[model samples]
Target: MEEGLENFVPLIKRSRGYEELEKDVIDSGICSGCGACAAFCDRVGLTEDGSVPASECNMTLGAVKCNIDGICYDCCPHVSYSWGGLEDEVFGARREDELLGQYLKAFAVRSKDKEVLKNAQDGGAATSLLLAAVNEGFSDAAVVTGRDDSWSVDSTASKDKKEITGGAGTKYARAPGILKLGENLRKIPRLAIVGTGCQIAGTRRLEKKFLSSVPKAELTLIGLFCYENFPYTRLKEIIEDRLGLKMEDVTKTDITKGKLHVWTKDGKKHEKAVKEFADLAPESCVICRDFTATFSDITCGSIGSDEGWTTVIVRSQRGMDLLNAAKEKGYIEISDKVDLEAVKKTGGFKGKKRAKVLSEREKEGKFVPDYS
Candidate 1:
């Protein structure tokens, strides 16, 4: 019996989960379901669905470390500021009308991956810019949106901030992952944040709230051209019940090649041709007045081109310098094209239409609608 007790003690000491949880800090936002151990030398692990098994994570007395540090628990953006915490260092700015004059600052960029272009909700420009910012130390971390594992259908990720690294291209889902900025601002001194029109507007508001204390050097905003985002519940219904695909089987989904393409493991490859899905664009998006992400230092999307590239509009001198430096460093290939004015015109037209519609509505006594 003593021999058996000694053997069990050694077994507990050999736990991988225990070691990682006790030693290594977990970054919930960057977890890709690559199941390694948590800490503690225990066997606690991540599932393919990106969730952790709570049963395996149960802690008991006699354990050297408490189980408060479970990776599964640590990995939740909803819980820990571990993924990306917002600190008091954030400075906010408000510049909605200013966004229009800054419209000319945007431009487009492209890559050959039809997959990358298509998977991106807009042009691949936002992802490229984020990569460039991190590479140049313009920011130590980037905040972008992705699908919430909990809410599979919502367009918003977490309505909180997330720290993303090694840009795997843009996550074109309908969720807001940048909402956590308030919690994470302390850990990250320099941050590059990406958001849609309304979110950026909200970010500007937040910036203003923190402006007195938060330094401008701590934050950079990149706004994506948002047309509309589908609600997650309805989207799930459409994809699963209507299209006959399981949610878990889906590896990726995005608007690409002028269509909404969905890839699933059920041996199904389907698409909503741009014609059909384009009209389904959210009404909130149509009514939104900001088309060029004017509030952002740089605005990126595919409003200008049908082919493979992101249209990046640089509104501030800082934005221009960043792009030029990226070119100098060879992180991006810069080419001056003649059609830039034309692209700006396209964005302007859309912005005008949106503003006109909103004005008409406001005159009739309506508040800015919140669709998400």
Candidate 2:
């Protein structure tokens, strides 16, 4: 090997950049496109198009700018992530429960507002939380997901009740939920990021690293319980081909009780075995180890609660304060009774499954990673 070229390949492999992320994770078909790299880094850009997916980090247009301090590398949760370390760092206490994580309160929660209830999935708890965060001034703008004219989902910084409500329903497709978070950093004093485990993991790293510049103390992170997210086109094929229903005709989608329940415009509900959509799940989701978004101040999902109610896990002091205020202000209601054990049972199963996959990958000598 030539003197100058001898260390080039190894150096590139070792250094962390968008290009590195592209080759190792994205091109390897493991990039979830959670938008953490795009949301926080100035040098990286993410696109949701199929042909030029977020997995494609275009180095021809933008080169590496992270070699100086490795700040961008630090922002990625996948490069190397330790859930237990982060939980202790963020919460200042070790998690006693393995699956459901640390929480001050657990509840089967529902929205008091009829509008949110009508539009949201699972009793509107996540949407209701975003609305309350905005109304209570805990957040000036929120990072949320909404659909376009073509019904494609994307992340946006929502500033008002209308925008928050517009992003209410679950699209059930994987989209970059925090792709544009940095754009609104200066515009909004306090910003709340709502996303799945992958996105929240990346956001948690970014929040911790960029506190001074981004007003770290003012930020709020809320997470969703995600077992698996599906590919859009494959999901459509399953819904339209097997179920014989047009994608547009389906009004809302929810996964509960081992079925994919799709509601339509005619006020009719269609159910399909979730196993039918198994092949449509992304390659990235297969090895992910987190089902509960344990890093966030608050995490909400439907797994642990009764039907039409969201399982709420208030994980931080800030989350507790916000939930209390929201309840007092007539935004959310706590369930009279909750199955606390149910959250643990479901979440533990998901965690165990993920751990097995991660262990298998390690045995196979493949790259085992989390997400950013």
Candidate 3:
């Protein structure tokens, strides 16, 4: 237990459980299946149809079900969050602009390493940072989202740069990097974790408790910018069946300037207007209000940078420190143009859309949507 946790009583097994989760989260279409529930419980898992639900084995006597007394509930990102509190913990203050979160610097950067740039989604900043952290012993490993054999997203932990780089690039589809993490996280005591908004939120929500559960583990979270995400199989179907492109022929995927582009190893490209695939985006993601992953140590994405460069948002001082150290070590190079307007334009747009959706939901009287 952590220092203050010694005074906290440990949970007994009786609590509101999967039944409540199904009603509030699963049915509500906000369950991202990040698997924090299952990471600690045997009875909960992601179902075949891509939903996270508690298994029948959770039932004990006729009506009683197994539970950890709302442990899973507290870990849920959709149920609760306070970015202000998280920023306070990390940086001792939050940014004045609610949309920008807290940050030390924003820049256009790319890896100086040719190998990383060749494989990364944009500038390779995220990959380069992780590579430096792991190889230089700043981290034991890193949890990352990468492609599985079926082209679906796979969440994994990697110690070596080879394994890390293999998972690079933009996987625009939904992969609960948090959920797919499974048991591998147990082996990583000190490390970095990268994921989308929801995943980062989950990590921050459960950071201390989750770390307490693990023996010596501590985490530095990296959040990827996300407007929305689609189901993996459905996205693959759109590419193969609808667009007449084979999945095997695809090597890269990117969403840029209102277009979806998939490129092959040979540099061939298949393109689709961004709106054409919008309806396939997850219902859970549709109401999401986060654009820059305001709660993470750092947020990186392709939105504000030129081709082959990434715009990095450093939230915590630690994030800036790691980035600077990596740059000094020749991991990456920085661009002179720091484009705040470009970032603000896109981030603000998403924030507005989020507010409109939540405002409508609040008026409908179901409940006020609070994804803080």
Candidate 4:
């Protein structure tokens, strides 16, 4: 037996393995691909697509059987759980603002660092905040999403300013960022994470489950506004085949004002309606309602801000403190001129869309998470 195998044997027997997760979540097509299930288990890992299982359940390979209360299933954001319960646990009350969820303040912010602004998407607020957190000793590292030359997204744990800056720009494709969290959680005591709604939700679930083992303050969540995410291959196909743009020549991509804009290295821009690629989005996104990353300490997006700024929604007191500290250190500039109604309109649309999707799934006898 391995050094720690005996201790995990008892827990493994009491926990549901990947088989149940496959049937209930993956097979049902509601898995968010957050990688929470595979993050904590050696037997479970994601396939090359960054979603779905890599192999069968190792625990059930022979005569071993898995039981209920598995960590994999329990930590999944797609599994049935009380959204209100999580809200209350995180914010001390259920959200009154159904659209934006719980928030203490909102701002139109931009980064003061020239390099960060140059490399980041929107105003570089997320990158600046992460830099401040690591520089000030609030966090030892940050797990962020970055892309390669071909726009393939992946997650990395950045421990320094240069590493964090490298992960500045956004990639429209989904990457399972929680895998990095699980890998570095034990080694890095203080960590920050930047992710979309589903990824943040999974992190919150992990935090709640391992609260005794890991303190709540150990992890900081900075959420990004995500309406939906596309598989990298499909998105690449759309760019290469449909838009007639080579992935190698594409410099940047942005979604704003209902349009998907792709910029090439030669300064040529290609544009298409955002809705044109709706069919390419993941099936799991249909059931997701977290447009503003409601569970995060701070949420950043381009929805309610100007062309060169990011809309910042501060949710927790810790988030506020961090933002203030960053501002004091001259990492970013904040303005109280956000278009709240604009943010609300986008979030409300997502919530309504999710409700309709869930209703349809319920009627079709498909598995749906307990939103109530």
TM-score of each: 0.57, 0.85, 0.87, 0.91
Residue-level lDDT of model 3, residues 1-372, one tens digit each, is: 333322222243444456666766777676766666666566777753457766664643333344444556666767755666666766799778666677888888899888888889989999988887787667788877788655777777888778888878877676656664435555565778888877787776666544455445567788888877667777777788777887777887787777888887588888898678667767667677677787788898888778888888888877887788888898989875667777778767665555776677667644334545
What digit string (tens of lDDT, one per residue) describes model 4 on residues 236-323?
8779877988988998888777788999999989998867877776768867878889899999998999988999999998899899
Better of 1 and 4 by lDDT: 4
Cα lDDT, all candidates? 0.48, 0.71, 0.71, 0.80
| Candidate 1, 96-182: lDDT as tens digits | 333343433444455333444444544455665666677786877776554444334222211221223223334444543433453
Model 4, runs deviating above 4 Å: 1-17, 54-69, 215-217, 351-353
- Rank all candidate structures by their lDDT, best first, as comma-separated numbers: 4, 3, 2, 1
How many Å off is the CA of 371 in candidate 2? 11
Which lDDT value does model 2 have at 320? 89
Best by TM-score: 4
Candidate 2 residue pairs that clash:
none
Comparing candidate 1 with candidate 2, which one achieves the higher TM-score?
Answer: 2
Misplaced by over 4 Å in model 2 are 1-15, 49-72, 349-356, 370-372
